[model samples]
Target: MQQGSQKIYFFLAMTAVLWGGNPVAVKGMLGEMSPTMIVLLRFLGISMILLFFMFYKYGKAALPPRKHVPTLILMGFTGVGLNNGLQFTGLQYSSAVNCSLVAALSPAVTAVLAVVFLHEKLKLRQWLGILISFLGVIYLIAHGSLEVIKNLSFNRGDILFLASQISWAIYSVLGRGVMEDLSPMATTAWAGVAGTFFMVIAVLYQGTGVTFQLSNFAWLSMAYMIIGSGILAFNWWNEGVSSVGPNRTAIFSNVIPVAGMILSVAFLQEHIGWREIVGGLWIITGVYLATRRSSMEPQTT
Candidate 1:
């Protein structure tokens, strides 16, 4: 493999680690911070971090082009705003296990959405990979109990997590266009600034007070969400979509559930059944099939 390809895969894998831990962090913040506050603070903190770096590098041109301003704002709304908002809120009602399990849908969701909106095509293997991965998610979450999946007692939180995945899928597809000129960090920075603007407005409108007396763990959790997941993972994801295309890059998202499940088992003491092992294999196989070097070339516009 070429050096560039290695870097791209590395970024995607690290992004998975960050993204996977996001729900566990959110699970920690459930009682300490309101969902809106978490979203507001996360974006605000990341935007500030990104701005400092951009200003040092480009000075006044840290501001994006005027024509790109609106698109950036919309991207922020969907990507950071709606996506994080739904996720944090949903995490309040759902277990971290459920949230991560549901997030496993993101890759397939992104692929289908890309085909519909971005006019991207998938090789047959990639499509099959997506299907198999989805089935794995079902089996793992349902613990191999088909009746549970058949009856599918999805609560508000599960539905919201699904929405969050859709929001992110749209964000991922939209990112390909935006990255035409901007680097991954630059793109995440500007959209984050735009997204933070709207989040602040909503926070104020809702009269949510910022609580300062958080424990050390809560602070650390928020920091992870801001720096690790919000900033780094996003930049990595943008790079993946830009260089490898969404379908191949999104396959890495399968790692999120696996990571979240492990962490949840350790930290949250969530129980796991035999189905996790079986379902996880299906997901791994699907990712391997979907991301084979021969077919994983970047799609053209």
Candidate 2:
């Protein structure tokens, strides 16, 4: 690979790794904070961090123009506002493993949206891969309990998690146009600010109060989410999408569930059933097949 390609891959991998551990971090914060509080503080922290970068690098140009404000707010609502709100709320009911498995479907959804909205065509292998990955998601959700379909209690959290995934998919598809004219840092900063404002409103509506804990784990997790996943991962992901295109870059999201599951098992001592193993393998295989390039030649729009 060329140096630029290698750097893109490295950044993409870093983004996945940071995002992969997010479930565990969020899980840790659950005991210390309310879901809305977590979401609110997360964006608040990220917004501050990004603002510093904006001021340092671009000075006043970091503030988006009036014409772009509406688009940025929309991006904020879908990507940060709804996505984080739903995911964190879902985490309250579902296991981290469940949330991670469901989130693994993001790439497939993005691919479909790419085809529908962006008019991108996928190879046959890509379609097959998406199908396989989707099946894995279903398997994980059902836990191989086909006989108890109707008896299965649907958790509100699970539905919210699914909504979060869809919100993110829409954000990814729609943000493509906005990204054409904006720097990733500017986009992320502005969106985070908008999301933070919305989250504050939601928190106030819910009558949530902020409470701070000096516990090492909670502090560390919050710091990681703010710096690692919030800033670094988001920027790197936007950069990867810009460099390689979303269809290719979206595949890296497949790594998130795998990493989340592994961490959950190792650190949390969570049990990994046969269904989870099989489903995870299928998801990984599908992502690989979908992302693999057929020829060395780079695709051009």
C-alpha local distance difference test of each model? 0.80, 0.81
Candidate 2 lDDT for residue 148: 39
As for model 1, its CA RMSD to the true structure in angstroms is 3.4
* Model 1 accuracy (lDDT, Cα): 0.80
lDDT of 2: 0.81
Clashing pairs in 2: none
Best-fitting candidate, scored by lDDT: 2
- Tell me which residue pairs clash in candidate 1: none
For each candidate, what TM-score against the reference? 0.83, 0.89
| Candidate 1: segments with Cα more than 4 A from true spot | 1-13, 137-152, 235-252, 275-288, 291-301
Tell me the TM-score of model 1.
Answer: 0.83
Cα deviation in Å at residue 229, candidate 1? Answer: 2.4
Candidate 2's residue-wise lDDT over 161-267, tens digit each?
77898899888787777767877777777888888888888889999777775589988988999989888898888878778776678668777887888878776
